[model samples]
Target: MTTWEPKSDLHHYLRVAREALLWKLDGLSEYDIRRPRTPTGTNLLGLIKHVATVESGYFGNVFGRPFAEPLPWLDDDAEPDADLWATADESREEIIGLYHRVWAHADATIDALALDAAGEVPWWPEERRRVTLHRILIHVISETNRHAGHADIVRELLDGAAGLRADHDNLAPGDQAWWEERRLRLEQVAQAAGQSEPRP
Candidate 1:
């Protein structure tokens, strides 16, 4: 067996989380991918756009290695949360392409810096801005995976599709009918429990 390296393991998890978020966009049309399915305006393509900007900022500007590309959405004059959604002119391919490039940029930072390499997050408070490569990697990995989980729910709401990945679903074994029955059973239990509750 190969020896475990902290950096390599962290990178692997980060990549996995990135892929999981991207996979939610698979087989979706421009309209569907851009459609906000939740009250919070969560959408597949928007999530991709958001994460791209997120990675670019965290790995680029935070580390003093800024991305060459100009992110208009992240500009000082831009509206708040502009990076959270795609505009009309921004095609799906364009956003996805940007995300891929961001991944490469982030990977380059990870590759070049040692785990102990120091950096500062300019946007963060002064007292807590200083950080190391190891801390950033863990933070980004956690952030990416959190968005991936949101994407999973958004995709499920869109088409009832849910899984950890293409190869492994990690869901309990059940046919469509079985799953429906399970849902009904849960609803019944919930209703019964609600009825038994004493008046407040």
Candidate 2:
């Protein structure tokens, strides 16, 4: 039998998402990790950087427990989306290290507070700014998982690697030739559907 501790369960899932996102960077060159893969400039390293900043704010400042380290890129005067991309001077190790530190800090906050502990989001609209630890945990977990999904797609686009995790890809078994045939079949079906008359 397993005891269901809600907080612990949420934390476990959050860590899963974090690890999945970071794993996307493994075995990739610096250029590959940092290069913009999407038209909107989404990249693997940038995704990690952006989420670190987000977790720092939500788990740190939101609960009146600010993360000790200063993040100049997150400052008000800094350029927009400064946290989204790492500059040439910012090595991959630094960004990854910072995220690990953030995990420690956030875990502390989660440990020290109860699910119902009161907190306030300074940036949220006044009426809804007040929140509980449970709410914040759910919020951050959702955010982390969302970025992890993005990481999965971006990593696949980069190197043809796609999976839910290193050990378990959670994908149907298929070789490259099988996948190619499947893709062609889907494309043909899509074209046929496009040619069908509207059902209005």
Candidate 3:
């Protein structure tokens, strides 16, 4: 049995979220990983890049422990949404490498600070800028998991792959034909309900 402390538990969940997000990039080509799969231009590599920036800011800058690397995407003169996509010059390896570095930085912050250690989010509204390590941990975990969910959908769109993690899928057991039938059945039910509704 493994004994778990409060901070360890939080870090555990955050790590899981991080792994899930990175898993979405596995078995994908450079083009496929960088290609926008949604109307709003969401991509797997882009999501990872965005989360890296998010983690660096929240864990590093907010705590006055700045990341060593220069971030042109986050510069004051940079174009909008610069952090949300990878340019042609940015290789998959480079982006993923940066994300790994960010994970290390964030982990160091978690290990060094107490849960109640104080910090300030300068980018946040002034009234709500003050925060603690515990609050930032929870916030980053939520944000990372939210992006992981988005990655799940985006990966499914790319290659029909969907799972909660590498080992456990957490999906209903069904073959392709069974899934098609399920979809049709749901569509029929929805159509029947629609037909029964009175005209507005």
For candidate 3, write residues 31-127 as lDDT tens digits: 9999899999999999999999999999999999999999999989998999989999999999999999999999999999999999999989999
Clash count for each candidate, listed in order shown: 0, 0, 0
Query: What are the lDDT scores of the predictions, listed in order?
Result: 0.92, 0.93, 0.95
Best by lDDT: 3
TM-score of 3: 0.96
State the weakest 10-residue window (summed lDDT) of model 2.
191-200
Residue clash pairs of candidate 2: none
lDDT of 1 by residue, 1-200 (tens): 99999999999999999998999999988888988988878888989999999999889998889988999998899998888789889999899999999999999999999999999998889999999999999999999999999999999988999999998889999999998999999999999999999989
- What is candidate 2's CA lDDT for residue 85? 91
Error of 3 at 199 (Å): 3.0
True-vs-predicted CA distance for residue 171, candidate 2, Å: 0.7
Residue 126's lDDT within candidate 1 is: 93
Q: 159, model 3: CA deviation in Å?
A: 1.1
Q: What does candidate 1 score on TM? A: 0.96
- Models 1 onward score TM values of 0.96, 0.97, 0.96
